[model samples]
Target: MEKNKAYFVVILIQLIYTGMFLLSKAAFDVGMSTCIFVFYRQAAGTLILVPFAFITEGKDSSPLTFMTFCKIFGLSLLGITTSLNIHGIALKYTSASLAAAASNCLPAITFFMACLMRFESIKLRTSSGIAKFTGIVICMGGAATMAFFKGPELRLLLHHHLLPSHAQLNVAEGSGSGSIWVKGVFLMLLSVSCWGVWIVLQVYNS
Candidate 1:
């Protein structure tokens, strides 16, 4: 019964997420500026949270020191601004399916970053290292497949599509009609890097 319940919850999540994906794509189809979209997201969140943060923390709260502010700014810029800007802009030049397929490599990127940080490691004699390293290689192969391969390659081999994907909308304006797919890839990579740093910082903080 518990297993069935878990499966039902998972299915529900998938259905809701799929609906969200299509809705967002529809928003993009209907025309929205990336900046406006981002602004709305931030402003709406701030509208709700700012008062809460202020009231809960207190009027004389000194949590946001210069260094703390810097960290927040850096995170917002790197993780949010750079990533979302590039992602939205890139989407304008590429297909939603393609972008979604490409972004899935993100987990592997995080795993590799974790290994680099000594949070995780590989040892040859042990099966664990070899297994993880192999998984990493496979993940890279998947990313490369999305980037370079044009056709429905490997579709027959895998039951489900192993392509790239993400949750973003509001394609950016400008750059005057060029292949921004590469730009998308670069932004995704940059976002992954930022996420890697975030994970490292989180580990350190903990």
Candidate 2:
């Protein structure tokens, strides 16, 4: 039952994340500033977590040392502030699908960072290590393929066919500039790298 609940929670989170990508893109279309969006997001997150943290661990938590506070601040900067702000900017210049696809490279980035930090070990002769290595390589390959390859479009008969005039205009407007797309991709990758570093820091701090 616990395992089932965990699986359900994971699925729910994934759905929420997918919805966020779509909704964020729509918000960008309507002229929302990325800075304002990120500010509100972070503020709301803080409001939600503060009460929960106080209620759950108010008295039981140990006193935070200066180093611990610094670590937490660093984590917030890397994982929340920098990552989310850059992600919002990336979404403005790229399609939601492309942004999400680029994010799928995160596990590979995290794995490499973890190994470099000595938090993860890889034994070439061991099957588990070999499997992990292969998985990371495959993930990198898939991310690169998505970034570089634009295959033939699968045009489905939908509302676009019914309203071809409006659809064509919308399509033209939605087509982002190549340079801006490249910048967005770079920013997305940098955000993921920051996230990977945050993960390593969490492991080290733990």
TM-score of each: 0.63, 0.84
Which 10-residue window of candidate 2 scores lowest in summed lDDT?
161-170
Q: Candidate 1 overall Cα lDDT vs. reference?
A: 0.62
Find the candidate with the highest lDDT and give its number: 2
Task: Give per-residue CA lDDT, model 2, range 1-206, as digits (tens).
Answer: 88799899978877788888978877776778988998987788889999999999998999999999999998989898898888889888766777777777888899889988988888879999899889988988887777666566555654655423434435754576667777877888888888888888898887
Candidate 1 Cα misplacement greater than 4 A, ranges: 1-25, 46-66, 152-178
Q: Model 2 lDDT vs. the true structure? A: 0.80
Cα-based lDDT for every prediction: 0.62, 0.80
Look at candidate 2 and give me any clashing residue pairs: none
Cα RMSD (Å) between model 1 and the true structure?
A: 7.9
Which residue ranges in model 2 land beyond 4 Å of their true spot? 151-176
